[model samples]
Target chain A: MSKAGPPKSHPLFVRITHWINALAMILMIGSGWRIYNASPLFDFTFPREITLGGWLGGALQWHFAAMWLLVINGLVYLIYGLVTGHLRASLLPLSPRTVWADTVAALRLKLDHTTGRYNAVQKLLYLGVLALGVLVVLSGLAVWKPVQLWWLAALMGGYEGARLVHFFCMSGIVAFVIVHLALVFLVPATFLPMITGRAPAPKTNEANE
Target chain B: MKRDKSLIAATLKDIAPDLKRIERRLFLRQSLSLGALTMLSGCDLGSGNAVQGALDAMSKWNDGVQAALFSQTRLAKTYAPSDITPNFPFNAFYTEAEAPVINGKTYKLQLSGKITDKKPWSIADLRTLPQESQITRLICVEGWSAIGHWGGVPLHVFLDRIGADKTAKYVGFKCADKYYSSIDMPTALHPQTILALDYADEPLPTPLGYPLRIRIPTKLGFKNPKFITEIFVTNDYPGGYWEDQGYNWFSGS
Candidate 1:
């Protein structure tokens, strides 16, 4: 506020975990797709080249290995976000009204990201995916150990149902990745902050890029 | 050692039609772009032996975690007959056409390792042991499940009858098919785990292991090896067919 410029953004914990989570999610989704292709839920299946493991056995190995990272890193990120209040500062205050307005403005290409505060649409997407990330892990546990975690599996509608929910949760994260990448690419200035912890303030005399 | 990308796609489409239900729907996900990822990882697109070793180690680690976390007394849910999968799937390393025809007339299940009664038992003798049946789902590692009424002497009955050493570490099975497997000693004694010889109250079908099978409801299907020809109790480790191939040895689900 004193410098009359865009505030410094993205805590170091957020950036580090973001990149690690990005890596883990990629492997998990890829191998997960390979596993899915082995016995798909319906008539359509994802292409194999896009899948992670080379075969059924290999995919399973990669999936289980990568699972540790996703679970552990995701938990660290969540806890850190909570303790630091970064989640509240950047990702909270989502409501139907704000989300509706933000979504409308976004579709019309009028919503702003340079304000250094997350828009309602960004908050909703991040928070929703955060919640879904927890579901993904829980549902994964349900699928992974249906007997030991019968209560969790029952919450997911049982073993078969948990598999379905896990797949959809993966889809939700994938969709988030797509939208997230698009927005970042379109606004290159925001991308550097995730890596370097802050972006240069917009020059007051200069036209917005 | 090589893969045909299109064939993988075709196989997925083929299996999808067999999916169980309307609530069971499919979805797609994303991965790193192919070229950039390949260059970055240097994981051999072929062989991948080093990566495979690392993953196998990881699998072993997971096996330890699962074994520690496993609950001995819990039972997999029993399903109503109406909930049974319409056509209980026939899963094997080879197709049903390749199922070996073991001559049941002379077929005797051999026993060995830390047991007092080592005499082989005929299929008929197995059927005569105290029998119980339950309709339970056999969930596969490949993400589909099917339920069937499996009836036979509980595995613990067989183990106790043979006087297997109570503190042994593992129970191993040799299959009539080339596929063989083993289970942790505790899982070998689970209440629902059976040396199943009958399906739906009839003698086992050829495709479902005609003479005998091991049905441990708490485990994924692969852990329930079919076409069992020999059983043993061992303090030494007995690595399985798939377990040797990098799957978790204790593949409970």
Candidate 2:
């Protein structure tokens, strides 16, 4: 590790918001599963053991409570990402060819595990999940207040349609999380930097001296 | 070789505390399990833990927000007659077989509280009022909904006829089925709110509140109490059966 480069691989605000988002996501998803079991759209139900609240009423409490955390923290993250140009700088220039190449490399276990740089695949995933987050929140609002937020419900194709959209968006987020966690475990060095906000400086050819 | 070994040992010793701290933080993050979330929810009502208290406070805050967002002009969507759910599912805290069978002949719609006229009107007397019909959806808190046809006198017209105190905060219902609920004044006066006397153009079925029920499409199904025996206008919060148990009081849709 060299001392010549900037110490933080992730900015202070990014680390803080990331952890809060993680907490909020866990709470929301666990309770939301219990709520879904009340009137399941699909044949299968989420197992009771994995669900947060013991019953539907308790689950509703958790769902409504965690929503504020998710929304406010998400807003802070979005504003910071945009204003600081972190989002643009890290996730931009994502082309289809680059994504295809990265996907192949990732599958073959040949992609570079660069500490501070996002590859095209990573950029696409991050951007896609962010969009899903916004959609999930909007659809949730429509379901929660179909009459008061009639326009939103209409945009989602009405009350029943909004519920379907919300469920699918939640599914998308869960999928992204699975991949995100697997990547972290595969490159364990990345996990520490997310917590400590620093990474070992990238090895330069001249550093061999 | 001996000098290099000593230098490596010294570095390990220096970073031992930082490594331990990272491991501890990672362990804490990994232990964010469902069990921890269950404890945070404090699922048992009346247990006064900080987490439960915070959740309760947030639920109350949401109630206020919903109330503020409610608009007199914003009506629940009405469905075409063909859109009505065939055999709309019956829902209540109790089983359908337990639904009270009221004798429509002897039944009287009782009025109390802030109303100037305390007269009890019978089914025949209610029929004289102008009746309107709408096919509107009834959404339940359990995430299910059904659309049904309901015909009755608009509640505002009834309230006016009874000389109800329009400024009263709540209009509460006491039902023959022992289920009670209340709605805010604005909701009570909503153009679509009705004292429904018929379902599907037939004298209300026994399972569907029979003689009379308050048909409020704007709120959750629980808020629209069936088999209503008394209607009271009051300033006090008359918490409903389900609401007293933890459902948001102002659960406006």
Candidate 3:
């Protein structure tokens, strides 16, 4: 609404990885639903049956194929994050002043108004999605190799329990995607930095150029 | 400074719409390509003959894949029989007394629903038909497994006798205790699959389906209905109690 601040931007690698993760996640969800639809849950079924290559067989192929994409992309992200210091900076919500101020700023819709790489809420959400990604993979492994990784099944309560958890985790990601897109539209500039790696520079003299 | 704000905002505003357009176009192209593939393959739901053909082709492909991946490893593991659990617990349906109630005196199983003929047959009727048996491991989706010798009638023999409709999507099993389970006809009629009247070579224990139970080798334990009542066919999916909760209805091994 007002000229609140100048722009900053995301790094090129960060943007690239972000977009790749988005694409992989979308494919995973689509095919995952197809697999889930083979035996529709509850009274609910997919609005339309997708026989990608044909029915359950096609859905399995799509799911396994997309699964590899998600696993590989996620590993790359995690490894890159660790090797570089981006992981530390992205994770740390330390300091009461920064955390409280950023929390208040985020709740007040002041995040978009302030000048920073990521607001507190953004950091929290990013962290959450990352954690969920890990859980999704782990729970998936329990389903994939139920006998081999019986311990994982035990941790999740059982094989059926693991499947339920995996299903719910995917559902959660779907829910998150809805809110994420809404947020993207609500703060369109927030999405721009993700793509172009650029934002309005802060009024600080260093950013004046 | 103000110029930069709107410039930045304007630039950023284009990103989402641009990305969304690109993603949608890509998805459309991929969907088109997939549609072409399906058209070439002729994949459709419920077209039983077509579905059977597709399954046959898939089985062939899977066989080749399996051969390449696992055929060389081992044909089958020979167990000492002692290696198997001695007192394999009977995972009962619903509860001990809660199975579907077939007439205790008459003890007839009615074959109805998506069938050419609807007839009620006694347990003696089933025994007169072709019989089969196999010793196999019962893998539960609950994470435990047990090996047991199962003896019963071949489902195809019964299906043939009852005259199953090609369009019958499911074989609905109504048990004595109101417990019900539906299985795809293909899985129901697998050669390895049986409707067991006995377990471990003796008449099945009351807790283990006594006079009748289903022994589905390729799927999880829950699909095996115990203390049989009526078997019907239907195109509509009739989910079992567990399947209704969240477990996969067709939980194949």
lDDT score for residue B90 of model 3: 53
Ranking by DockQ: 1, 2, 3
User: How good is the docking of model 2, as DockQ?
Assistant: 0.24
Candidate rank order under TM-score: 1, 2, 3
Per-residue alpha-carbon lDDT of model 1 for A145-173, expressed as tens digits?
Answer: 99889999999899989999999999999
Mind giving the per-residue lDDT tens digits that candidate 3 earns over A130-185?
88899999998776545435577668965667878888888777778898898767
TM-score of 3: 0.49
TM-score, per-candidate, Cα-based: 0.88, 0.88, 0.49
Candidate 3, position A135, lDDT? 92
Best by DockQ: 1
| lDDT assessment of candidate 1 | 0.81
- Per-prediction DockQ: 0.39, 0.24, 0.03
Score each candidate by Cα lDDT.
0.81, 0.84, 0.64
